[model samples]
Target chain A: MLEITDIVTSYGKIEALKGVSLSVAPGKITCLLGPNGAGKTTTMMTVAGLLKPRRGNIAFEERNITGRDPGHIVQSGIALVPENRLVFPDMTVHDNLRTGAYSRSDDEIEDDIARMFERFPRLHERQEQHAGTLSGGEQQMLAVARALMARPKLLLMDEPSLGLAPLIVEEIFRIIRDLNAEGTSIFLVEQNVHQALKVAHYFYLLEQGRVTFGGSPGDLEEDEVIQRAYLGSAEQT
Target chain B: MEFVDYLQAVTDGVMQGAYYALIGIGFTLIFGVMNKINLAYAAAAFGGAYASLGVAALIGTGDDFGLPPLIMFLVSAIAAGLFAWIVYTICFRFTPDHYELATLMATVGAFFLIEEIAVHSTAGEPMDFPEVLQGIVDDPMIEFSDAFAIRGDLLTIFLLALIAMGLLLMLLYRTKLGLATRAVAQQRTAAQLCGISVDRTNATTFIIAGVLGGLAGAMIGAAVGVLSPLLFVPLTVKGLIVTVIGGLGSIPGAIVAGLLVGGLENVFLALRGITERDMYVMLLLFLFLAFRPQGLFGKKAVRD
Candidate 1:
């Protein structure tokens, strides 16, 4: 489980995350839905230790991970699939995945890599190919698979479906569901509320760097303003 | 008749290029990993070579009661690597990452700092380096038509440079540390997201490059038969020239470009005077910049 309380993050003169808070329960997909510039990615980055917060705390399964080094945060079993699926372009797919397990010193790394190949067959097919050459959908899959190589207790996926085709979006949602079912907790930041609601057990709507609503899909559907803002159809939701 | 002389000059030029390649590879690695050129690199090279000279001077390189001839190279390499790490931490570590110019300017200052230290320490005088290829540079090792023979010392430098290049290539492609370094080079943020410490990788990269630089300095000292603070600025300029011609971050490009520049410089020196020689070299650099901005091996506008 992950818990964030009243965190504020900034870049130079501008504060991106201002007094924000959220929680992700264990073994569940917790989706954070927000519009552009709503501090969704910033929240994930702050929790992942990429961005330092000016105030507040982040607890990952009772350990206060706030202000920890990114490498230490990763070692503590949290892996982030960053926005744009920033896979190392010049690196081979296999090398990219290997880098994903950089913090692990266990003997099972090769085994895990083999397991990853099996889990993501497309990755296996192009394991030796450079990741930059991959299609956007393939790169997204590779990014997710790369993060899974870390064997994290919590997976932080930032905009996994952005710029992906519709069919690929479905595949991404399916993968998220499968990952959650396999007991890996996912804290996903997404703009696609409809597809997100289908896989997520709980969803939090973030607006202007603050959580406006937290509820189940059924509850979210009944909220008129939330449906209009995200789903774009108060009549259907 | 004159063609034979030109050919000999080019051959000799290629030998000189070997030294440039050694130092240029180090510069290329630093540029690749850190994305910031360390202007102090050649200074580090000079510093390392001088430190080795100090050791060699103290212990002597003779057979009895002295260190082995090759031990100085290793000593210089390790010392240079550590020295470079210290410089990296002090000069560039905490600088804002986005402002690459700031780091570049800081390194410019570091270059002066390192050069001044060398100058003050040695009283700005050229010191003779212990000859690596003993009793051979004046004599031809492999004679060809009397005019195109490979000088023993130059041949040795070329062979040593080739070996260094081979080892560097192996370390980069066939090792885990190299993997992390390449990852960091390609995408720093993505590398971090994967739990790879970009800072540590960048540091390791600098150390590796510094080791290479030290070897280059030692080789240059051995070849030129002298060590002087005056060699510092010129070597740094040559390195920058090599780095640019070889493509900004491309190692293979750097090596090839180094040899090209070396060959061209010698040809020009033989045909035109020394003044005209450098002008030709500068012109070649300009051509690469104006026409082929990507340089010899830069095939793509890859990095953002």
Candidate 2:
């Protein structure tokens, strides 16, 4: 479980996240939906320890983890599937996966690679090839598998389906649901409201630099503004 | 007779090219991993050679010294590697984020600072470099003609160059540390997310490149059979030129560029003499800058 409270993150003088507070329930798929520049990716990056917040307390499993280094946060059991799936382009698929487990000093590292191969067969097929050569969908898969290589309790996925095809989007959502079903807590930042609603038990709508709405998926579906913004029809009307 | 002379010059150039390539590789590795130009690199090479000379002098022909030149070479290389780590800590480690020009300027300062130290220490005088594996051959090596022969000392330098390159390739491709290094070079942020400390990886790279520079310095010292403060600026210039010709951040490019620069330097010296030799090399660098700024093997800058 992860809780972010009154967090304000910035780029120089411009504030990207303005006193934002949200909670991701344990073992649940909590989706954060917002328009571009709504600080969605900024929130994920801040939580991942890539950016330091000007004011905030981020607690994972009830221990404060804000302002920690990305490496420390990773070792604390949080892994990020970053926006645009930033896999190391020049490294081989196997090497990319190996790099994902860079923090882990366990004996099961090789076994984890074997497990990742089984989970992502396409990755295993092109294990020796550079990750730059992978298709967009496959690269996304590598990013997810790479993050999972850390064996994190909390997985932060930022815009995993951006620019992906509809079928691939469906595959991604299905994987998110399956992951949640297996008790891996997911905090997903998505633009695909309908697909996100399909998987997310809880949803939060962010607008500008603030959270505009937060509720269960059933409550979200019935809201007028959300329905109009996401679906063509407004249920309230 | 003229053709034979040209052939001999080319052969000599190629042999020395091996050492040039090693220095180029140093520049390439440091730049590729850290995106920081190490101007201290060649100076560190000279420093290593000088340090080895000191070790040899300390040994003073004792029977227990046990292959004095070989031990001297190893000490020189290890010292150079440590010197590189020192350069990284002082010149680069504490520098603030994203100051590429600042780091470059700092390393440039280090270049002069190190050269001055060597100059002061040795009083700007050339010292004799002991030969490695000498006196075994009855005569020099004859490749084809009497004009194209290599002396035993120069032959050791050539062989050492090839060995350094082979070991470098193995260290980069066949080790776990190499994987982290390649990841960092490809994508710094992503590598960080994977929990690889960018700073540690970069420091490790400097040590590796520094050791390579040491080997190169040893071979260079052996080839010239003399070490001098005068060699400092010229070696640094050659390394940079090789880096440019090889293509920025490309290992293979550095190798090819090193050989090209080495061979051309000799041919130019043979034709136009020492005073004009470096003038031509500088001109070649200018041509590459104007015509192919990316060098011979430039890869596009990595996008985030």
Candidate 3:
């Protein structure tokens, strides 16, 4: 479980996250929904320890992890699949997977890599090819598989579906659900409201660096603002 | 008849190019990881050379050059690595990652600082450097033909440079630290997310480049048989040119460009004499900058 309290993160004079608070329950897929510039990616980055928060604290499993280095955060069992699938372009897909496990010294890393290849068979087929040469969908899959290489207790993914095809989006949602069912908690940031609603048990709506609403997906269906802003009509909402 | 002369020039140029490649690779390694140019690199390298020469003086080999070439090289390389560590701490470590210009300017400052120290100490006088094969044999030149031959010292330095490059390639491609380094170089934030320490990797990178730079300095000093403050600026300029022509972040590119530049420099020297030789080299750099700025093997995106 992860709990964030009044975290304020900034870029020079401008603040991206202003007193934002949220919680991700254990063994569940919790989704964060927000418009562009709503500080969604900023929050994920902050929790991943890439950006040090200006205020407040983040606790994972009741231990304060605020302002820790990203390496320490990963060692504490949290891994992030950053937005835009930042796979190493010049490195081969296999090398990309190898880097994902950089923090661990366990001997089972090869076994875990094998597991990743099995789950994402296309990655296995293209193991020696440069990641930059992969398609958008394949790259996204590689990103998720790479993150899974860390064997984290919690997986933080920022917009894994952005720019993906509809079928690929469906596949991504399926992977998220599958990952959660397999006992890896997921904290996902998504722009695809419908697909996210179908899979996310709990969701938070962030607006302008603040959390506006938090509830079950059923409760989300009744919110007029969210329906209008994210979903086109009440029926689809 | 002219072909034999050009061939001889190329052979000598390759021997010289080995040192150039070492220097260029030093620049390329640091640039690949940090994406920030450390102008102090060459100064640190030559600083290592001067330190070894100082050691030679202390050991009473100041006049006769009785010290073995191997020990001199090792001492110079280690000292250079230390100098680089100082540069990294002062210029890069505390500087905020986003403020790249700060690091660049700081390195430029470090460069002048080291060069000034060397100048003040040596009083702008050139010191003699030990030759690798001077005392080993009576005839120090290996001849393939009447027109083609390599000095025993140059040949030894060339072989040593090749060995160093081979070891470097092995370290990069075969080791876990190298994997971390390459990962960090490719995607800093992503590497961080994967729990790679960017600071540690950067520091390690600086030291590695420093050692390699030191080796390059020793090799150049050995080849030219002198340690002069005047050689620092020109060699540093050549190193940068090698980095650009090889491709900013490409090691293989650096190696090829170094040899190409070295060979071409010699060919030009054979045809046009010394003053115009550098002019042609500068012209080659200008052509590269104009037409293939990404360099022979660098990805175009590196220009971004």
Candidate 4:
């Protein structure tokens, strides 16, 4: 479980997150949805310890993790699949997977890698190819699979479907659902509202660095203003 | 020129190129991983040369506490690595984050500090370093003709570089540490999320570079038979020129560029003179920057 309380993050003169707050229960796919420039990515980055918060606390399983180094945060069992599927472009797919377990000293890393290959057969096929040379869908799959190599208690994914094709997006959503079903907690930041809602057990709408709406999918779908706000023209149908 | 004379020049150039490659690789590796040019690397190399010479002197004096040549080399390497770590910690680490200009200035300052230390210690005089591979291999009779010959030192340097390159390639391609290092270089944030400590990785990278530089400095000192602090600045400049011409982050590029620069510099010196040789090299660097800023193999910088 992860808890964030009144966190503010800034980038020099620009204040990115102003007093934002949220919570993620264990073993659930919690979706944070917002339009562009809504600070959704900032929230995920802050939680992952890539960016320090100016104020407030972030805790994992009741342990305060706010201001901890990113490596320490990861060692504590959180892994982030960053935005844009930022795989190490020059590294081979196999090398990228190994990097995901950089903190683990255990001998079963190869076994874990094999397990990830089993989970995503496509990754196995392109195991030796440079990750940059992969297709967008394949690269996204590699990114997610690479993060799973960390054996993370919590997976933070930022816009996993940003530039993928529709079919690839569906496959990614299916993988997210399957991952949640297998009992790994996911904090998914997505723009694809319909697909995110289908997989997300709980949803929050972030607007200008604040949580504007928080409820179950049913509640979100029923609320006329919330539906109009997120779905736009799709809501008329 | 005679065929044998031409051959001798080519052989010498190739050996010199290997030393240049060693230094150039150090420059490129640090730039690749940290995005900071360690202008102090050549100073670190000079410091290692002095340490090697010091060890050699102590051993020659029949000091029972002295180490063998190979162990002395290792000691020199470790000493250089520790010096580099200290320089990085003092100059770059504690500085404000992401201020690359400030870091560059700090490294340049460290470079002067080390160079001054070497000058003060040696009283601005050149010191002869003890040869590890002495009369046994220093000048094996390789006679091509009456006018041309080759020394065993050149051959040794060339072979050593080949072995170093082979090992470096293997370490990079076959090791988990290399994987993590590449990951950190590519994406520090993602690497950290995978539990790689950025600071530790960076320190290890610097140490590796320092070791390479130490070996290079020892080779140069052995070949020239004299080590001077005055060589540091020019070596640093030449190494940086090679790094830029090769590419900012490409390993193979550095090796190729190093040889090209070394060979051409000699050829120019043979034709025009030493005074004008550096002008041509600088011109080449300018042309590369103007036409192909990424060099032969570097990727274009991607904006986030």
Candidate 5:
């Protein structure tokens, strides 16, 4: 449902993405694994239209959305849960979700918000509380729930498990899997390779702004070099 | 020497406070949304008064295309708002957002530009504004000590300001637009990620401030019976002083500080003299900056 062709993005003199390219099919959880400063977040931002690329194109469901404004891109069916879970700290949980559907003119915004609350009961409990007051896990949940309020065709999450406890990380992964199972295509960027490989239908390894490996998780699991680079100190099993 | 005199002074203090609150609220609102102070606000307020005077003159005369006094005031407000938007777009918006010094200098330039325009338009002469609340309540009998009294216009300005403040409070606390504005103010990048248009939000914020400033300007003109460019520069300084003493971005701080400044200034004028009155006010501002730089309601700065 999403296609990126050799997009190059940069900041001042430093180029973050040097002609990186990738794709995600419909209703699948595609994971991009990368180390620190591997331009993973840059790639996600470019796709979300936050940063304009200097070269190549980005297409969503056969429509070219390369240079559209971020607001227009989001309205056209792509929602990004930005890195670091940058929820509007001063706004209440409900307001943050309402802000997510800012472009929608539909009458069921309150219903959608209620549905999100039902999906995450923790969010309902803290609906009136300031988002910044939430715990890290709850804030991550709020960020993901906020993205879902946009009702996008694809959800792009950047390092949703960063700085979370192991149990909370597992819960986040489970939510990702459940959302994918419900036919919402997800492009997740993570450094947690073992857990990502277990859930990702297909995985790509990005290093130095290049996609070095792309295949099914089983194929990557079988490769010794890929396994060592990804697993690091942990056992590949 | 009498209870009536004390009551009259208090009544006058409240009226002056209303004017200060109106101007201070504009200053605070602009600073809250943009994080940049518009030093040109006082000048804009004076500019609105001039517009009101000109429009009212045209209406009172046999001009076929003139608007009524109320409609003229609203049009004057819109004109002032448009003028403010133009000034912001031209002066501040193009400059780097982080170079706050540059933004400050731009607003200073705008201040002088507005002052010069007012002077040139009126040929440095003060023009009288038509009484907005004439005959409605110009002479209300007061039962206070049989001597001291208050004008109907003073009461009207004070009551109207309170009403305006109530409306503003409702807008900020209850409206969706205000919620979006607050989000943008808190975090621009996060607000943009939520698909809130930053430019539109900022523009709306400026227009709102401009309208408030305009109303304050008209009331001041009515109270003083004349509008002049000379008043622009002093009002600008006083507004800035109020904003700083109240707190940078705190709405309630602005209201409380505005009244405090207004009451103190009048009390000093009553006891001492007008010449040394501003010295005490300036000293208070210095103390606020030197000690509690956060003023009343400002948040503690988070170190980066």
Candidate 6:
């Protein structure tokens, strides 16, 4: 479980996340939905320790993790599939997965890599190929598999389905559901509201560096702002 | 010009290329990790070499109770690594990451700062460097005909460089640190996201390159039989030339390009005079920039 309380993060002169607050319960697929430049990625980055907050704090399972180094945060059992699936392009798929397990010196690394290959068969077929040469869908799958290699208690994914084809997006969602079923808590940031609403047990809408709304999908349908801003587009699609 | 003379020129050039390869490897390694050039690298290396000379002068390399030849290398390497750490702290650690120019300027400042330090300490005077294989007819030469021969001292330095290069490759390809380094080089954000301490990795990379620079400094000193601050600038320029022609971040590229540049420099020296020799090498670099900017063995533009 993770709790973010009124955290403010900024670039040089501009505030990207201003007093934003949210929570992700354990064993659930919690989704953050917002339009472009709504600070969705900023929230993910701040929680992942890529960005430092100027105000407030973040607690992971009651442990303060605010402003820690990314290494410490990852070691605390949180893994992030960053926006754009930033897999090391020059590295082979196998090495990429190996790097995912960089913090762990356990004997089961190869075993976990094998398990990742089993789950993503396409990855097994191209394990030795450079990740940059893989297709966009394949790269996304590799990114997910790489994050999973960390064996984190909590998984943070930012825009996993961005720029993905419809069929591939569906497959990604299926994997998200399967991962949640396996007891890995997921805090996902998504723009595809209709698909996200289907899988997310609880959701929050982020707009302009603030959390505008938070509720179950059922409550989403009843909210007027959600009806016009998000579901309106989902229904049209 | 005789065919044997040309062959001799190339052979000597290749031997000298070993030192260039060592220096260029240091340059490429630093570039690979931080994606920024350290202009102070050669100065750090010369500083190490000069420190070793001071050690040699104090302890003596001539008698039964004297310092072993191996200590000289160790002193140079450790000293260079220390200087590199200082360079990292001053030039790289505090500078903002996104603005690469700041780091670049910082390193340029470091170059002059370090060079000035070395100059003040040594008083801009050249000192004799201890030679390997000290006693031999013609200082020991391997004859391939009367016209072509390899100087024993240079051959020893070349072989030592070869061994150093072999160990470096093993460290890079067969270790966890190397894996983290490569990951950081490929994607800094992704590497951090994977829980790698990018700062530690970058710092370690600087030290590793520094060690290589020290070895190169020792080699250059041994081959020339002298150590001087004046050699720093020319060596720095040559090292950069090697890095670019080898590609920015490729180790194998550095080796191959080092040899190529070395061989070409000598062949030009043999064809023209010393002044025109560098002109050809510069022209070669310009041609590479105009045509294959990536250099031999360099990867095409990296994807985000």
The best candidate by TM-score is 3
Ordered by lDDT, highest first, the candidates read 3, 6, 2, 1, 4, 5
Cα shift from native, residue A234, model 3 (Å): 16
**Whole-model lDDT, model 5:** 0.81
TM-score for each prediction?
0.94, 0.92, 0.96, 0.93, 0.92, 0.95
In candidate 1, clashing pairs total: 0
Lowest-scoring 10 consecutive residues by lDDT in candidate 2 chain B? B59-68
Docking class of 3: high
- Estimate, for each residue in B73-95, the C-alpha lDDT of model 4 and write its tens digit: 56667778777787778776788
Q: Show the lowest summed lDDT stretch of 10 residues, model 5 chain B.
A: B63-72
**Each predicted complex: what DockQ?**
0.77, 0.77, 0.85, 0.75, 0.59, 0.84
lDDT of 2 by residue, B1-304 (tens): 3987877777788788888898999999999988879998999887888888777667676433334566777888898898889889988999875888878888888888888998898898887786665654665565665566665666677777788888888877887798888888888888888888889999999999888898888888777878888988889889999999889888889888988888888899999999999999999999999998899998645566
- Alpha-carbon runs more than 4 Å astray in model 3: A222-237
Clashing pairs in 6: none
Residues A130-204, candidate 6: write the lDDT tens digits: 999999999999999999988899999999999999999999999999999999999999888888889999998
Give lDDT tens digits, candidate 1, residues A77-166: 999999999898988999888888888888888898899899889999999999999999999999998888889999999999999999
Off by over 4 Å in 5: A222-237, B1-10, B62-72, B138-143, B146-150, B302-304
Worst 10 residues of 3 chain B by lDDT: B60-69
State in Å the error of residue B136, model 6: 8.8
What value does the lDDT take at residue A37 in candidate 3? 82
Recovered share of real interface contacts in candidate 1: 0.78
| Model 1: per-residue Cα lDDT at residue A218 | 82
| Model 4 chain A weakest 10-residue run by lDDT | A228-237
lDDT of 5 at A215: 86
Report the CA-based lDDT of candidate 1 relative to the real structure. 0.85
Chain A TM-score of model 6 versus the true structure? Answer: 0.94
